[model samples]
Target chain A: MSTRSLYVSADTPVHRLTARSKIGLATALSIAAFVFTTPIAVGIVLAVAFGALAWAGGLRNLRRVWFIVVALFVVGFVVWPAFTPARGPTVLATPLGSLSSYELRFALGRSFRIVSFIIIGLAFVSATSNEGIVRGLRSIGLPYAFCFAVGTALRLFPTFLSAADTVRQAQEARGLDLSAGNPIERVRGYVPLLVPVFVNAVRQVNDQSMALEARGFDTRGERTFHGKRPLAGRDWIALALATLIVVGTLVGRYGFGVGAL
Target chain B: MREVFTMWRDTRMILLVAVVAAVYAAILLPFKVFTILPGLTSVRPANAFPVVFGLMFGPAAAWGSAIGNLIADIFGGTFGPGSLGGFVGNFFFGFVGYKLWGNLGPLSSGEEPNMRSIRQVVEYVLIAVASSAMCAVIIAWVADLLGLVPFSVLAPIIMVNNTLAAAVLGPPLLYLTYPRIKDIGFLYPELLADEELSAAGASRRYVAAYGLLVVSLVWLGVGLLVGTGAAPGTLTVGLVGLVGFVLVLAFAIIGAERLSAILERAGARPAGRNR
Candidate 1:
């Protein structure tokens, strides 16, 4: 029932950058993770991502979700190699198959890549608010209506979650045993819970739409914002750095064959 | 295709998008504990929301599902590179059901969107499965391309998860809500201008689109089996599958655009709101 978002309020250089720049940096780091297939290259990207997270003061956020990070890392490091075909020198013989050093390196690199993505995503979300996301996307030239919908959706998430919990409680009070069923039965049990929630939502749409239209929601022409801030010099520097990282990784991976597993 | 963008113009449709996004994400958040693959996917009973909402609200649900899944990932601690794929995949997960529901056999003769009859139920299940498979392919393919996961491993998992949720929960929810929503004059077709709902070239163009979809899915399915069975960890097969997927998806997009253009040319008039 916690309504808090991942954004941690702080005054840091990473937090000072605009959401658009953070988004760009995250994208660049993600692409770098995907492009680089060598353990060393992936490790470097992971390091940079972690460094960004630390700079954003969001390292605690990473600690909060450490279980998932560790689980994914384990899956990638231990389980993924089993799916990969053994190649190069054989490291060990097991009942399933012979383990290869090449597969181990591939697994390690993949794990690092996934971890780097997580860190970059954490850094971005930790520094960006829901309004910031909408504003940043608008600044990046997405249509106003789409951005408005996204912002509204984010704002409504907590409200809907609270409503759903209330409904679940009311249903349970009415003898709806949600936990005492098999998987299919449990899924079917959701019908009672979902029907009322959805019906109520549908009913609200009329009122909500009327209210929106009353506020000149359908008005056309250029709109002005109350607190719009143009991207500063630091924003451009962040953008340039993100572009450099992506282009550098791309060139290193394909152009020079530097990161091939 | 036009409705996808045009829905943003209608206040009701835009509100529906927000409601769907909020509802879907809210339901999805609690289910994060049932993780089948950490940071990738889970046993998502919330998957049913997209199909049901899609059938009721049309293209708004498509956008909603995409945004909703992204929201879930962002809050649920699973957001990552693969989430880009999840966004697009969940859009089709909601989209294909509504698109095919009214266009496919038995239901293609301009039937109202309902789950009243056995034949209609069959069609619904078929659409759910199709949407589920399409969603799976898009996500698994992207994951494979990104080297995050193998296609052969992830596709079936997502397919089963989505189809099971949609098939189990879709009918009763749709049966209960469709009539009420329609009565309230909130059905997508009721809210939009008739030009937005124009059916010109729909049947033929959809046939082409669905035909290509089936073929591409089959191609990907075979590639999945080969990639997993014959040669695990091979890039060539995955690349070939990607090419076929992209080619077929491009044709499907073209077919949809042609349908939209034809509808625009036919100059369908608005069916004024009954309310």
Candidate 2:
């Protein structure tokens, strides 16, 4: 399995930003990407997202998500025209019957929107660690219980992956060729692999519950956490800029309908 | 609300949630990476999670499924603002599955399913189908509103994917795991509710099923009207209408049976006492 984190721990401006600010900015940019439906507006957002990724020294992470983006582009290319309710004058192609220029434009705009969303999202993940996410969520008024639960969940992800790997290996040793069979047979083959993992996982749960009880982990009160980075002025400025981009696009799209197809 | 908080307060329960979430994400991320439409949708074996986890872990499983989806999104490189919709929608998958399963019939005391009993098996299937439909409706509706994808395209795909995964993998796992965990002394969510609350819960599920029955019937009616009134080439609309009609009838019939079963059990008990 691939790793859970793509964080680079760089010292660039984007990495130095507080996790809360980065998360907020990612959310704002993603909303803007979804709201706007024009090529130019989405193209600009994509440019800004790429710029941030470069600043964070996390452009390397783009390699991981390229296939997904290409898939999105391809699927949208086919589906948008076939299902689009509108008919246009300009015919773009006759492959699989006639296609319209208008549908192609629609697909391009949608693809740009998707690309911008992924770029900003990956940039945020590349810059922030899991611990940083807990702190960020806690600082933003989320309950400590929620933060702890999510933090523990993030920490344990790799452990489960390792356990699954062990199970798969053991099954392979016993002649389970998951890839060699037809689709239905492969799906059936996964049962032996999964049942053992799930049963072992339940067994592990018993040990976990006991360990937690020994730690007195249920005591409820105000708790203290160390090593949380305070949001500085630059974080605020970054958030403000994100807000402006989002608001500007919303106005352009809805107030004047400038970005409508 | 109190049960939700209580589950959170228990450290062991919290640990269970974490472990379940981690396992779920580990299973989910691989499928998520190679997507039909990366950010919008995918063919997910990950869909099997809510039913299995919910049956095993209860409310914590709901929270775990939601958080796990977010983690999987990040790992799969599909994380975005749209994740908010995913969070809420995925939560319902577990919530509804566990709630409906525990209330509908006796299912071997939360340890293992009594697979020989056809009623229990039907209950499991009903929960899986209903949960998949609920998750699909909420997530796809939000995606449509966000302009992520058209509702017509997204909902059916998600519903089919989730249902297929759960139907294929859910029952045998339930049968296998129940015998091992039944004696573990941990508090299962089915044991959390009193008899009165469970009966009330069953009634509420019936109400939800009836509501879905009405909405789906209306959808079929509208589709038929448009199909007949419009040009002869609109055969697709008519077919879609027929499919909608069939799906809703299945839901209604199963739901009514469950309700009747609950009532019979209640009536068989001593007077003025909760089952």
Candidate 3:
């Protein structure tokens, strides 16, 4: 578990921006990343995105997602070419095989496209807390209750795994050997292991609801903030840069097309 | 503010469990176990995850499982309205278990499950297995009838697949609820502390000591009945799953009905007391 999911964070300028803005930035960049078939454009965009992420989330955290990045890249650049093979003009050659210009382009385009998606996703998850996200929604005049549920779901994700781990440990100590045996025997092992995890989960929620009810969670009153979460000057700069890059690239791709480029 | 933060953190732990289930359901099943099951082809953890979600988080959990499965299908390129049917079917699969616990009010006359009565244990297993089996079969059958999924490709697989999921995952999920429910706050107090682990729960522990006996009896029985293609074997496995589902439901119902009776006679009895 690299634990570098979209949820990890640092209170940098990028982190302080609105979650919706971050989401929009990623979505827009991903669309542009999809447009440019030239590896040169993708290479530039990836470099810029990587720099932004390193500044926002720390290079170390970005490095943690290398396996995921590599895996997806492999799926895009290698696995897909193998499956579909090249059908268009010749572009890249290898001793083992050669890629048609179109196949090579598709794979290269996809790799960069998805890379942008992942980087932006990582940025948003890293920067935003579910509370701030929910409050941000409320600030936009969205219903608070629905935002609360979504926020709660986001917050509880990690805790659920810990409980599941606890159940796995309990079964393992009892010599249940969940990891052993053939595939069928192994899957069968989960019944005993996961059942308990589910049990604990249900029980935990009931307790949580009771605790929340005690604390007047549902009372119709103005909510208060506990921690400092603020928008800073640098956050706006990152947003502006992301916007410029996205708009410029899209305009370049659409207006010029490949021949003009 | 600190108290509110701490409480939110605590609740996050519970949601984390759902996330774990979602991730495990997505990642683990695809790689080896789901893929390499020799006789079985394309047995998805996606459908059963909804069941597991229902068991864990009441009805609300099913929504996440459903959405998660839908998302996984989209990425995996297996999405269709047919799968959407499967999602709904899977929701009912969990509803079977949650329905048991939520049969009465939220809580009142919950009864503890004990294996002292073998007959009751048998009955419990049957209902749990049967409930989900019935749900799976009906959904597949209706979908086929309604032309949601083709009968040629999906109908048989759906029944066997759903039943396999229910039979395999449902029982243990139902059974494991006993020990953890107290800490989870599903019960009014510690239900399992006074009561010994049920025959099903303790069955794994005793397997070593009674290794031969269990192997000869249970495994041999599995071989004979399943090998011989007896309906009874299928029925037995199916029902056994419900054993826990039935027990949990029994407790939930009993607790709901008997809340006043029990609460009226509460901690007045003092500590170190058995219910």
- iRMSD, per candidate, in listed order: 2.5, 3.1, 9.4
Q: Which docking band does candidate 1 fall into? A: medium
Q: Model 2 over residues A1-261: C-alpha lDDT tens digits?
A: 255587878788888888889988888888777877767777888898999888887777888778777776666666566556546776655555776667767777777876787788889888888888788888889888888889988988878878877888998999987676654455556677677766676577768777867876664777876765776999989889878877887888889997778
User: Which candidate's TM-score is highest?
Assistant: 1
Candidate 2 on B59-115: residue-level lDDT in tens? 777888888888887777777766776887788677666455534434312223434
Weakest 10 consecutive residues of candidate 3 chain B by summed lDDT = B1-10
Q: Which DockQ values do the candidates obtain, in the order shown?
A: 0.57, 0.47, 0.08
Q: How do all the candidates rank in terms of TM-score, highest first? A: 1, 2, 3
Query: What lDDT score is found at residue A201 in candidate 2?
Result: 65
- Report lDDT (Cα) of residue A123, candidate 2: 90
Q: Which residue runs does candidate 1 get wrong by more than 4 Å?
A: A1-4, A82-85, B32-40, B106-110, B202-206, B212-220, B229-275
Off by over 4 Å in 2: A83-88, A95-97, B31-45, B102-114, B190-205, B208-275
Count of clashes in candidate 1:
0
The digit string of per-residue lDDT tens for model 3 on A35-78 reads 56666776666776676677676455456556556665555576
Q: By how many angstroms RMSD does model 2 differ from the true structure? A: 6.0
* lDDT (tens digit, per residue) of candidate 1 on A141-224: 988888888998999888888888899899999998876667788778888888887788668888888898888887245788
**Superposed Cα deviation of residue B119, candidate 1 (Å):** 1.3
Q: Write the per-residue lDDT of candidate 3 for residues B1-275, one digit (tens) a residue.
A: 01111212233333433443345344323323453223223454334444444444433444444434433332232223334454554444544443333222222123333222444244334434534453444344333333222222233455456555554554445455543543344432222122211212222322321231122124223322432345353443333323423433343222211211222355321233243
